[model samples]
Target: MKTCLVVDDSGVVRKVARRILEDLSFSVREAADGQAALVCCEEFMPDGILLDWNMPVMEGLEFLLELRKRDGGDVPRVIFCTTNNDIEHIAKAIASGANEYIMKPFDSDILREKLEEVGLIEKVDP
Candidate 1:
Protein backbone atom coordinates (compact mmCIF):
# COMPACT_ATOMS: atom_id res chain seq x y z
CA MET A 1 0.00 0.00 0.00
CA LYS A 2 1.12 3.53 -0.65
CA THR A 3 2.07 5.56 2.40
CA CYS A 4 0.79 9.00 3.31
CA LEU A 5 1.57 11.52 6.00
CA VAL A 6 -1.20 13.78 7.23
CA VAL A 7 0.15 16.95 8.85
CA ASP A 8 -2.41 19.07 10.67
CA ASP A 9 -2.51 20.83 14.00
CA SER A 10 -6.15 20.02 14.57
CA GLY A 11 -6.88 16.62 16.02
CA VAL A 12 -10.26 16.52 14.36
CA VAL A 13 -8.83 17.27 10.95
CA ARG A 14 -6.16 14.68 11.35
CA LYS A 15 -8.67 12.07 12.43
CA VAL A 16 -10.99 12.80 9.54
CA ALA A 17 -8.16 12.81 7.05
CA ARG A 18 -6.77 9.58 8.44
CA ARG A 19 -10.05 7.80 7.98
CA ILE A 20 -10.39 9.04 4.44
CA LEU A 21 -6.83 8.16 3.50
CA GLU A 22 -7.01 4.69 4.99
CA ASP A 23 -10.28 4.09 3.20
CA LEU A 24 -8.46 4.87 -0.01
CA SER A 25 -5.94 2.09 0.85
CA PHE A 26 -3.01 4.18 1.94
CA SER A 27 -0.93 3.39 4.97
CA VAL A 28 -1.44 6.62 6.87
CA ARG A 29 0.59 8.43 9.51
CA GLU A 30 -0.31 11.57 11.40
CA ALA A 31 1.64 14.55 12.76
CA ALA A 32 0.30 17.52 14.67
CA ASP A 33 2.76 20.02 13.25
CA GLY A 34 5.32 20.50 10.57
CA GLN A 35 8.16 19.93 13.03
CA ALA A 36 6.80 16.53 13.92
CA ALA A 37 6.08 15.80 10.32
CA LEU A 38 9.67 16.41 9.42
CA VAL A 39 10.79 14.03 12.11
CA CYS A 40 8.40 11.42 10.81
CA CYS A 41 9.71 11.89 7.30
CA GLU A 42 13.23 11.40 8.54
CA GLU A 43 12.33 7.94 9.74
CA PHE A 44 9.88 7.09 6.94
CA MET A 45 9.35 9.15 3.85
CA PRO A 46 5.81 8.68 2.69
CA ASP A 47 4.57 8.53 -0.90
CA GLY A 48 2.36 11.56 -0.34
CA ILE A 49 1.78 14.28 2.26
CA LEU A 50 -1.41 16.15 3.09
CA LEU A 51 -0.07 19.27 4.72
CA ASP A 52 -1.80 22.10 6.52
CA TRP A 53 -0.73 25.73 6.13
CA ASN A 54 -0.68 26.99 9.73
CA MET A 55 0.66 25.30 12.81
CA PRO A 56 2.21 26.18 16.16
CA VAL A 57 5.78 25.33 15.22
CA MET A 58 6.87 25.38 11.58
CA GLU A 59 4.27 26.38 9.04
CA GLY A 60 3.59 24.18 6.03
CA LEU A 61 5.47 26.35 3.54
CA GLU A 62 8.54 26.44 5.75
CA PHE A 63 8.41 22.69 6.13
CA LEU A 64 7.92 22.23 2.42
CA LEU A 65 11.03 24.24 1.69
CA GLU A 66 13.00 22.27 4.21
CA LEU A 67 11.61 18.96 3.07
CA ARG A 68 12.40 19.59 -0.57
CA LYS A 69 16.04 20.08 0.36
CA ARG A 70 16.28 16.75 2.13
CA ASP A 71 17.33 13.54 0.39
CA GLY A 72 14.40 11.52 -1.07
CA GLY A 73 12.09 14.43 -0.16
CA ASP A 74 11.25 15.17 -3.77
CA VAL A 75 9.70 11.73 -4.14
CA PRO A 76 6.57 12.46 -2.19
CA ARG A 77 3.60 14.13 -3.84
CA VAL A 78 3.14 17.13 -1.55
CA ILE A 79 -0.35 18.54 -1.41
CA PHE A 80 -1.03 21.65 0.60
CA CYS A 81 -4.33 21.34 2.37
CA THR A 82 -5.24 24.65 3.88
CA THR A 83 -7.90 27.26 4.52
CA ASN A 84 -5.91 29.77 2.49
CA ASN A 85 -7.68 30.01 -0.84
CA ASP A 86 -6.11 33.16 -2.16
CA ILE A 87 -4.27 33.15 -5.46
CA GLU A 88 -1.11 34.36 -3.75
CA HIS A 89 -1.07 31.37 -1.44
CA ILE A 90 -1.85 29.01 -4.27
CA ALA A 91 0.92 30.43 -6.41
CA LYS A 92 3.31 30.28 -3.48
CA ALA A 93 2.52 26.64 -2.87
CA ILE A 94 3.06 25.67 -6.48
CA ALA A 95 6.24 27.71 -6.64
CA SER A 96 7.48 25.91 -3.56
CA GLY A 97 7.10 22.48 -5.27
CA ALA A 98 3.74 21.26 -4.11
CA ASN A 99 2.16 18.84 -6.58
CA GLU A 100 -1.33 20.01 -5.76
CA TYR A 101 -3.50 22.09 -3.36
CA ILE A 102 -6.80 21.44 -1.63
CA MET A 103 -8.89 23.91 0.30
CA LYS A 104 -10.14 23.11 3.77
CA PRO A 105 -13.65 21.78 4.50
CA PHE A 106 -12.77 19.00 2.09
CA ASP A 107 -14.40 15.62 2.01
CA SER A 108 -13.27 12.15 0.98
CA ASP A 109 -14.20 12.73 -2.66
CA ILE A 110 -12.20 15.91 -2.88
CA LEU A 111 -9.20 14.36 -1.24
CA ARG A 112 -9.44 11.29 -3.47
CA GLU A 113 -9.68 13.42 -6.57
CA LYS A 114 -6.59 15.41 -5.64
CA LEU A 115 -4.68 12.24 -4.89
CA GLU A 116 -5.64 10.82 -8.24
CA GLU A 117 -4.74 14.04 -10.00
CA VAL A 118 -1.27 13.83 -8.55
CA GLY A 119 -1.02 10.15 -9.54
CA LEU A 120 -0.66 9.02 -5.97
CA ILE A 121 -3.73 6.86 -6.42
CA GLU A 122 -5.30 5.32 -9.46
CA LYS A 123 -8.93 5.70 -10.50
CA VAL A 124 -11.30 2.72 -10.51
CA ASP A 125 -14.44 1.95 -12.39
CA PRO A 126 -17.40 3.02 -10.28
Candidate 2:
Protein backbone atom coordinates (compact mmCIF):
# COMPACT_ATOMS: atom_id res chain seq x y z
CA MET A 1 0.00 0.00 0.00
CA LYS A 2 1.09 3.55 -0.63
CA THR A 3 2.07 5.69 2.35
CA CYS A 4 1.07 9.20 3.37
CA LEU A 5 2.07 11.65 6.09
CA VAL A 6 -0.61 13.92 7.56
CA VAL A 7 0.93 17.02 9.16
CA ASP A 8 -1.21 19.22 11.34
CA ASP A 9 -1.18 20.72 14.82
CA SER A 10 -4.72 19.61 15.54
CA GLY A 11 -5.40 16.05 16.53
CA VAL A 12 -8.91 16.24 15.13
CA VAL A 13 -7.62 17.31 11.74
CA ARG A 14 -5.04 14.56 11.74
CA LYS A 15 -7.65 11.97 12.69
CA VAL A 16 -10.00 13.07 9.94
CA ALA A 17 -7.24 13.01 7.33
CA ARG A 18 -6.07 9.62 8.54
CA ARG A 19 -9.55 8.21 8.03
CA ILE A 20 -9.84 9.67 4.55
CA LEU A 21 -6.42 8.41 3.52
CA GLU A 22 -7.06 4.99 5.03
CA ASP A 23 -10.26 4.70 3.04
CA LEU A 24 -8.22 5.39 -0.06
CA SER A 25 -5.91 2.47 0.84
CA PHE A 26 -3.03 4.58 2.05
CA SER A 27 -0.89 3.67 5.04
CA VAL A 28 -1.13 6.87 6.99
CA ARG A 29 1.20 8.50 9.53
CA GLU A 30 0.73 11.63 11.58
CA ALA A 31 2.90 14.56 12.66
CA ALA A 32 1.93 17.38 14.95
CA ASP A 33 4.17 19.93 13.32
CA GLY A 34 6.63 20.45 10.50
CA GLN A 35 9.64 19.63 12.68
CA ALA A 36 8.23 16.23 13.52
CA ALA A 37 7.24 15.77 9.94
CA LEU A 38 10.77 16.41 8.75
CA VAL A 39 12.05 13.78 11.12
CA CYS A 40 9.49 11.34 9.78
CA CYS A 41 10.52 12.05 6.23
CA GLU A 42 14.18 11.61 7.05
CA GLU A 43 13.47 8.15 8.37
CA PHE A 44 11.32 7.18 5.41
CA MET A 45 9.86 9.19 2.66
CA PRO A 46 6.14 8.80 2.19
CA ASP A 47 4.41 8.62 -1.18
CA GLY A 48 2.42 11.71 -0.41
CA ILE A 49 1.90 14.37 2.25
CA LEU A 50 -1.21 16.16 3.50
CA LEU A 51 0.25 19.37 4.92
CA ASP A 52 -1.38 22.12 6.92
CA TRP A 53 -0.31 25.74 6.45
CA ASN A 54 0.03 26.84 10.05
CA MET A 55 1.67 24.97 12.90
CA PRO A 56 4.18 25.32 15.72
CA VAL A 57 7.93 24.57 15.39
CA MET A 58 7.80 25.19 11.63
CA GLU A 59 5.20 26.38 9.17
CA GLY A 60 4.19 24.41 6.10
CA LEU A 61 5.77 26.83 3.64
CA GLU A 62 9.13 26.68 5.36
CA PHE A 63 8.91 22.92 5.59
CA LEU A 64 8.03 22.69 1.92
CA LEU A 65 11.06 24.74 0.99
CA GLU A 66 13.35 22.59 3.11
CA LEU A 67 11.78 19.35 1.93
CA ARG A 68 12.29 20.31 -1.68
CA LYS A 69 15.96 20.74 -0.97
CA ARG A 70 16.41 17.21 0.22
CA ASP A 71 17.22 14.36 -2.11
CA GLY A 72 14.09 12.45 -3.21
CA GLY A 73 11.88 15.13 -1.64
CA ASP A 74 10.71 16.08 -5.09
CA VAL A 75 9.17 12.65 -5.52
CA PRO A 76 6.45 12.83 -2.87
CA ARG A 77 3.20 14.28 -4.12
CA VAL A 78 2.50 17.13 -1.70
CA ILE A 79 -0.98 18.46 -1.14
CA PHE A 80 -1.33 21.56 1.02
CA CYS A 81 -4.44 21.05 3.11
CA THR A 82 -5.23 24.32 4.82
CA THR A 83 -7.76 27.08 5.48
CA ASN A 84 -5.78 29.58 3.46
CA ASN A 85 -7.83 30.03 0.30
CA ASP A 86 -6.33 33.30 -0.86
CA ILE A 87 -4.73 33.43 -4.27
CA GLU A 88 -1.39 34.54 -2.87
CA HIS A 89 -1.08 31.59 -0.52
CA ILE A 90 -2.27 29.20 -3.20
CA ALA A 91 0.21 30.59 -5.68
CA LYS A 92 3.02 30.36 -3.13
CA ALA A 93 2.19 26.75 -2.38
CA ILE A 94 2.14 25.80 -6.04
CA ALA A 95 5.34 27.64 -6.72
CA SER A 96 6.97 26.01 -3.70
CA GLY A 97 6.36 22.56 -5.24
CA ALA A 98 3.00 21.42 -3.92
CA ASN A 99 1.28 19.13 -6.39
CA GLU A 100 -2.20 20.17 -5.25
CA TYR A 101 -4.18 22.15 -2.66
CA ILE A 102 -7.29 21.41 -0.63
CA MET A 103 -9.17 23.66 1.74
CA LYS A 104 -9.78 22.80 5.38
CA PRO A 105 -12.92 20.95 6.50
CA PHE A 106 -12.51 18.57 3.58
CA ASP A 107 -14.35 15.28 3.35
CA SER A 108 -13.26 11.96 1.89
CA ASP A 109 -14.42 12.91 -1.60
CA ILE A 110 -12.48 16.13 -1.66
CA LEU A 111 -9.36 14.43 -0.36
CA ARG A 112 -9.74 11.70 -2.95
CA GLU A 113 -10.16 14.28 -5.69
CA LYS A 114 -6.97 16.09 -4.71
CA LEU A 115 -5.07 12.83 -4.48
CA GLU A 116 -6.35 11.82 -7.88
CA GLU A 117 -5.46 15.21 -9.34
CA VAL A 118 -1.89 14.69 -8.09
CA GLY A 119 -1.84 11.25 -9.77
CA LEU A 120 -1.46 9.53 -6.40
CA ILE A 121 -4.74 7.72 -6.95
CA GLU A 122 -6.77 6.74 -9.99
CA LYS A 123 -9.78 8.76 -11.03
CA VAL A 124 -13.04 7.05 -10.33
CA ASP A 125 -16.54 7.67 -11.56
CA PRO A 126 -19.02 9.05 -9.06
Q: List the candidates' TM-scores in order.
A: 0.98, 0.98
Task: Write the residue-wise lDDT of candidate 1 on 9-93 in tens digits.
Answer: 9999999999999999999999999999999999999999999999989999999999999999999999999999999999999
Tens-place lDDT per residue, model 2, 1-126, is 999999999999999999889989999999999999999999999999999999999999999999999999998999999999999999999999999998988999889989989999999997
Best candidate (score: lDDT) = 1
Residue pairs with clashing backbones, model 2: none
10 residues in a row with least lDDT, candidate 2: 109-118
Give the local distance difference test score of model 1: 0.96
